[model samples]
Target: MGMLKLEARHLLAAAGAAVMISAPASAATLEVHIGSFKNGGTIPSKYAFCVPAAEGHTTGGANINPRISWSKGPRGTKSYAIIVYDNKAPAEHREMMNKEGVTMTADIKRHNFYHWVLVDIPPNVTSIKEGADSNARVVHGKPATPSAAGVKGLNDYTKVMAANDATKGQYYGYDGPCPPWNDDVVHAYHFAVYALSASSLDLPKDFDGPAAEDAMKGKILAQGETVGLYTQNPTKGAKASK
Candidate 1:
């Protein structure tokens, strides 16, 4: 479990830096780690602009690409996919869904929330540049892969803001967090690295997190990740919690 754990859910909401392969990955597994200019090339800073946790700080011009670095890709690993998610979301995603308007209730905290899901990455790529996907929004059903190579997957954010045109669109790529304006603890964003046998996970069209994971099941050579923490409440941003 990367960015977000399966059971992790943030009631108030919102959500690493690292690398240390204690065990050898599957025959040169494609490893991904978070890094930041503030953390000396580690994971992205919890105080970045896109995150609600870093609300008042003004992001100091921090970019979205979290300085991801990787190594030891699996043999014949055509390409790689990275996913960042928040484990602290409402257990049942639709529990808060309503007819006229589905709203995220303040009481409905702690649920599975997927912040980012990227697919079809070029196997040759080791990592992404900082701020590459940050808070940018693209088109619907379009290929949202990086200019280098690959395609984008539908992140959970798509359905979240779909009602409003300005924010509506298929989140085919990365979309950072801006969780509740108020909350308790900082949310954890698990950055998972998967080494796949194919260039992409070929599942039914418009697959989500669980779907993608199932498609890649058993096919994954190895996976590893580093986590970063962010909280809507600024006090929690301290390094100790990370």
Candidate 2:
């Protein structure tokens, strides 16, 4: 009887090992790449919403969206999403922002400023060409619309320029970084890609970053990101890319 019990236990253990060996592996993290700059490297002025100006603190840049590509999502991934935002935006303090004497320190209060929010990208679409979303600055901002690549959603620039007559409008799609010129801290722009289980979030018209995030919820399968640094401050060693 003791020998029979020991053999039963051995059989159970063997079965457990077989089950473990046959089990599928977890999904791998997607590999994201930025064509214009290295990950965690400085971003060029050509891809910025603002750049160093000869006379003023800053001026409108090329505003081109850098080329981006990503690895295919794992099995069960139906679509993908791209979100680009600045993680080091200065806090709301009008008096000190852009002031020549004021130095926005690294420890200053910061917030996320969304520059691009595109969703519902097809699984087969693995890359976006340079300037495909935005080639130059639009005076009143581009129209919020959907295209072959994905749905272009409202960026933070809409709120940032709401009070300005010349630039005020519903800014959409890829509007690149424009860190405060007086800021002493270098800003990090995160270009993230999300692999989703669903084909579409079905976001509402004129949807923003928060709205997209709400829609993504539990549908995200895998995600990856690459960071690019930028600062309009001349002392930070960034030259205007003309």
Candidate 3:
């Protein structure tokens, strides 16, 4: 009877150890939404960088920032950061693109380009209204003043338009999609919202997407993302038929 009792105690201890080993760390949850378009859906032309227009003149889209919102962040989340990037841009010879007008092909390896970077979003703020940062063409350097919600960061458009005589300026805020018109592949724009533990990033005025991301490292409590598709080229069959 004594031996049986000892064995039962050992078995219970082993079971408890197993349970402890299998337990998972607490996870944070976040839900992201964009009212202008659905996840994995086609983005409207009005949100594109350049859209087909009359008189053979390519015109900029409505150039409005899409409405974005998120649910409550994790328990420790005190602020949020928004990043919009395109992972399908050609990686080769990006520096010479402006001077050479280099066209990116579908076969090349793609790289990321940051289109929008807004940071220090207050915990109480849950949404950004549409057209809040609208401009027909590119706008150079928005004031770095932090609003009640947050401040805007420099986007990749600043780099792209820096060499252009007419568009050259320190482009900031949201610049919509403007993928190559001849590429065979359609590009996807990823919009991510990160719940951060820090109340403010305290980033410098020159901070870009990468800068903001680096500052938020190890401070992120949760993250959620949505993708929107865009293309400057028409479908192959549709173009051929036309």
Number of the predicted model whose TM-score against the real structure is largest = 2
Tens digit of per-residue lDDT, candidate 1, span 58-96: 222232546677785757777777776767544544433
**Ten residues in sequence with the least summed lDDT for candidate 1:** 11-20
Which scores greater on lDDT, model 2 or model 3? 2
Ranking by lDDT: 2, 3, 1
| Residue-by-residue lDDT tens digits, candidate 3, 7-92 | 33333333223111111135365688999776766667767676643333245666778888998887888999888888777677
Per-prediction CA RMSD (Å): 8.1, 15.0, 15.0
lDDT for each candidate structure: 0.53, 0.78, 0.68
* Candidate 2 or 1, higher TM-score: 2
lDDT of 2 by residue, 157-239 (tens): 99988988988999889999888888876666778888888999988888998788778877877887777777787776655
Ranking by TM-score: 2, 3, 1
In order of appearance, the predictions have TM-scores of 0.65, 0.86, 0.79
Off by over 4 Å in 1: 1-30, 37-63, 91-109, 134-147, 203-205, 235-242
User: How many steric clashes between backbone atoms does each model show?
Assistant: 38, 0, 0
Q: lDDT, candidate 1, residue 122?
A: 78
